[model samples]
Target: MSCEQVTTTYINAYYEDMEKLGVRRATLEPRATEHIADIVRLVDTLLTKGMAYRVDGDVYFQVDRYPAYGRLSKRNLDDLQAGARVDVDERKRHPMDFALWKGSRPGEPSWDSPWGPGRPGWHIECSAMAMRHLGETFDIHGGGMDLIFPHHENEIAQSCGATDKEFARYWVHNGFVQINHEKMSKSLGNFFTIREIFQQSEWPDTVTGEMMRYFLLSTHYRGPLDFSDQSLKEAKSALNGFYDLFERLNESDPSHGAADQLLQEATVRTRTAFVAAMEDDLNTPNALAALQTLRGEANKALEAGLSGEMRRMVRQEFRALGVVLGLLQTDTWRFKGQVPQRASGDAESTAKTLSDEEIAVKLAARLAAKKSKNYTLADQLRAELASHGITIEDRPDGTSRWKR
Candidate 1:
């Protein structure tokens, strides 16, 4: 695939998980192919420092040259060989030394350098790209824990070994993903691609992007998320609860007095809980629960008809916390239609007879009011739209949209 295609796939997958568990966005996304210049530069510096060598067309890093090779992962060179594909290479000085640049095999992509023609080795790609984006040393570095060996460990060696500076200050590794009780295996015909899944559900293709994000984030990043029908259903239900509140709040006047106060208090608690959970290494499940609690408090206050600064406070808190969780983002709980979309064409036709446009229009109006700085009117419009299960956004770009 082209570099653009690979980056898009990575981004789509990342966003899908974020939406599901309510992560807003990342600081940056650096792709391997895009940082070829940096990789080549780093490779040259490594060679000049005697930490790397070019034999024929291939370049390899001298593992023994870095004395702290196993510091991060606590593995000896001998243990690495136990599971490594260590077929002898005549040009290689040692079996443990890995490729910095792989000499171009007939059809593969290659970039020219002092070391002949080849692409960067996979491990080096991350090291170079991450350093270029996050700097030689950054506060956090994260990836699946499965990458601890060879991949991340190698990154620490190559990046730090070349720059002679510290790499990531904190190393974060998310747990694994499995299907059912067994591991997800393609040979078992149980693998579900995002495309394949969206085709099966009534969920809009656009929303699938968010759904995948939320699903992944629903569980703590450091824990193994069990993928199954039950898990997805639970996620969907949680999503429904969140959107339901947003819809209701949109319909209720933004200046609904007491309700607004409740929203503000709930927002603080939600934010505090969420930050605490994430600070402890992105504990999403607890974060999710925190949102749910905030939701409950808001609902109680709204039902009791809260007013004044209290009502403003409640609304602000709900929106603030919801934004962090990536919930209450879109204007409507549109995924409800997604489930039924799986039905026959005739059923879809019948369902379509019930118009969503009316609600969408009202949500759009609420968004406009919010943008125009008419807080009370915006709240009133949101409340009106909520009765129809619509949600609204007065976005940073000064535009509004609705979904249901």
Candidate 2:
């Protein structure tokens, strides 16, 4: 298949999966079809500086000319030459000379260039595209760890040679996702696409886009993540635990609990710990652990009759932390949309599920208790309804509404 046609087939599938998976993107920039001016401009500058040469319509970057060519990948020129693809173009003086532009071939897209009608070489594509959108220099450049050797190394050479400045402040390379014990690749028949993962029937419940993201986040970015039915199950279950805690506290009034000093101090400690973890090379594993620790501390306070205000304080703290890690963005009652049973009396009993008429009568009785200066009884009724999964909100017009 043609390269453009083959590329489009997967790009289409990519957007569809990302949309369904709730992945948000700010912009989409296609590098290949972006105007060729930037690519030609850099190549021209290199040629003027004697870093590039043309032969038989092909342009090659002289690796020996750039002293710091292998600095990014931490290798010497001789080491690269030992494994260079010298046979591809024997006309080049050095074995490690990489192509800057490839002469047009049959059945391939071509664009007018200084050397001849040709296409930008694969290595130059990123440098041209990034400089066009970002600048002569950018903050960070990242790709999979596999690209660290030649791809990223060549990009550094081209960018620096043209601009005479640092190409990127930071170079980030992430480890690959593995299937079983092996690296996921097509030749091994172990490759699995995003859609295939979503279709796996072994997921705990319904496979959601959020679940897929959660699975990816379960491992640290620097560590190799193993994908399997068992691992996915663990990720799904862990995410569900967060949702369960959110729903449990959603209806409870923050004003009801008493001893809150324990929760207040714990939340402060948790925040400090979370920030420290994030600053340490974006240690997501430790950051996620901090979130889980906060949850545990909050639940401990809940068990000890922690004040409702303190309870909400803890919830808000953890929720803010979650936002940083890109988790817990959904509604609290998302999974609880199923049939809810009434809970009442001491936060554990099967309380009476009230109908509309029953609700009106109970609200009226609770209002009477308040009028009679029975503050304790009024609060009790509110708590009773809350425990039953029914939330009573006091409206502005001195009316109460309940949702179950």
Candidate 3:
């Protein structure tokens, strides 16, 4: 495929995966190639303003023109020059000066510009795209921590030099994600894709989108996340607890008595803690912990037999707080029994847990086995159902109810 086609395919797949993970779509999606005209205009402005120079159709930004170049990256020009990765190009004015536009080569995508046939440089493309969509100055710019250096620093220098205005008011750089305490790299044989994670057969329980979402948020965004099957399992188990509480709230009567002050106090405390944690640099780990504490209090209240009104109040609070973290929003009944199908592969062929109807059938057989005094068969059936995450509660009426 062509470069543009490959990029388009990747972008479409990225958006599809984000949607599956419950992330909302961005208000605007801008591609660098689509903004070529804007990029050319910015490059022309830099050239006219003497911030950039063209050599044999190749345009390079002059770092010496922008005095505050290394302010963002917090390195001096001497240090950057010492550690520069650029080749020894005597044609450039300075070693640290970077490309604003690269002269096109044969069989490469190119556009006509004042200089010649070429394409915008990597850093200039981002600056041009952002300014085109969000004006000269925007509130925030975010990227991976690795981009804080040359990429972001160059963006600042070129953008501010051209417009004589601040480019972005805030810069937010997030940390990397590691696999099992090691850097996730293809050379290391640990690189994984979202689809691969969902279709992994290492775990008995099928990994769902929600479970992956929760696993991501469980750690602080600014900290390196150590992703593993165990971490995913922990996330899934935590969500199960929340869903279990939701199920109890749904089944409990919600119209009989006054609210309990203790439970009410717990709910209020949870809200305060949740908000405070979020405000503190989006510290999701602490926020989740606050909700977990509330979950514990909620379970206690349930065991103590809360009034219907209090139960409803607690449930509403849980949902409201959970919405902020993008958790606990699925329907309680559906979430309880929902088992996402694994992607087609050997994983898909693996044995899956029984559906609710199938579980009921097994429960009925177990009941009949007990009625016939076949204690061995009844015990075997009970063990089998338990292994599939089902719990059977036998009632005094000679019937059993099953839950997951």
Candidate 4:
């Protein structure tokens, strides 16, 4: 495929993966290629402001023009210059000076610009895209910790130099993700895609998309997240607890009696704690702990017999708080069936024995048998499913639930 086609395919796959993990779609989506005009304008502005210089068809940002060049990365110009790698091209004003535009090479896509046919540099593309969509001074700029250096620093220098304003009010750089306590790299044989994680035969239990999402949020964003089977199992167990509580709430009647003051207070406290944790640098681990505390209090209240109104209020608060973390939003009944199950024998083999659609078909057949008063067929189907490591729970309303 062409470069543009490959890029589109990757972007589409990324959106699909995000959707699978229950992530909401972004409000605005902008592509660097689509904003070539904006990029060219920014580069031209940099050139006019004497912040960038053109060499042949290539335009490079002059780091010497921006005094606060290394402020974000917190390194002195002398230090950067000392550590800079020797480049064959000696046209740049400074060793640290980076490209704003690059002349097109053979068999490469090119855009028409005042400085001849070229494309925006890697760093300039993001700055131009952000300014185009979010204005010259946006609230936040986020990326991996690796980007904090040359990429983000260059962006700050070029953007602020051109616009004469702060590029962003806040810069949030998240830490890396490790696999099995080691750096996740293809060379290390530990690199895993989202699809690979869900479908990997190494794990004994199935990994659902939501389970992966939960495992990600269980750690603080600023800290390295160590991904392992144990970590995933912990995440699965935590989600099961929340879903179990949700199931209880669903079963309870919500139209009778007054609200319990104690439960109401607990819910309020949980909300406060959840907010406090999030406000403290997006501490997801603490926020999740707060939710767990609330879950415990909610369980105690449920056992102590809460009034219908109080139960309803508690359930509403749980869902409201969960919305902030993108958790606890799925229907309890529907989600419970999706939870992974572990049983005797080979897990991979057992998991493949029954697809969700196949289970649904069997459940329908069992229901049909029961309705027709053919108890023998229904019992036989139940036994057959149980042999495949599936558990079937028949409800009073003639509905069936299965988990595996």
What tens digits encode model 2's per-residue C-alpha lDDT throughout 314-384? 66876788778667776553323333333422545455555556666777888889889898999898887
lDDT by candidate, in order shown? 0.72, 0.75, 0.83, 0.81
lDDT of 1 by residue, 172-198 (tens): 898877887656678976677655566
Q: Candidate 2 versus the native: TM-score?
A: 0.78
Model 3, 1-404: lDDT tens digits are: 87878988998999877766778889998888789999999999999999999899899999999999999889888997888775769999998888999999987878988888988888998999999999999998999988988899999999999999999998888888898788889999999888667556333322367788788898888889998877887887888888778877766454343337788998889999999999888899999999999999988877767887787788888889888877777765352355554443454344576777788788889999999999899999999988765677675567776655
Please rank every candidate by TM-score, starting with the best. Answer: 3, 4, 2, 1
- Clashes found in each candidate (C-alpha, N, C closer than 3 A): 51, 4, 0, 0
Better of 2 and 4 by TM-score: 4
Clashing residue pairs for model 3: none
Q: Which stretches of candidate 3 lie over 4 Å from their true place?
A: 201-207, 254-259, 333-353, 367-377, 389-404
lDDT of 1: 0.72
lDDT of 4 by residue, 1-404 (tens): 88878988998999877776777898988888899999999998998998999998999998889999889989988998778676637887778888889999877889999988888898998889899889999998899998999999999999999999999999989888998778889999998888666555223322366677788888888789988777877887888888778766777554343336677888888889899999998989899999999999888877667776677777788789888878877666353344344332455445545667788899999999999999999999999888776778787678887754
- The count of residue-pair clashes in candidate 4 stands at 0
lDDT top scorer: 3
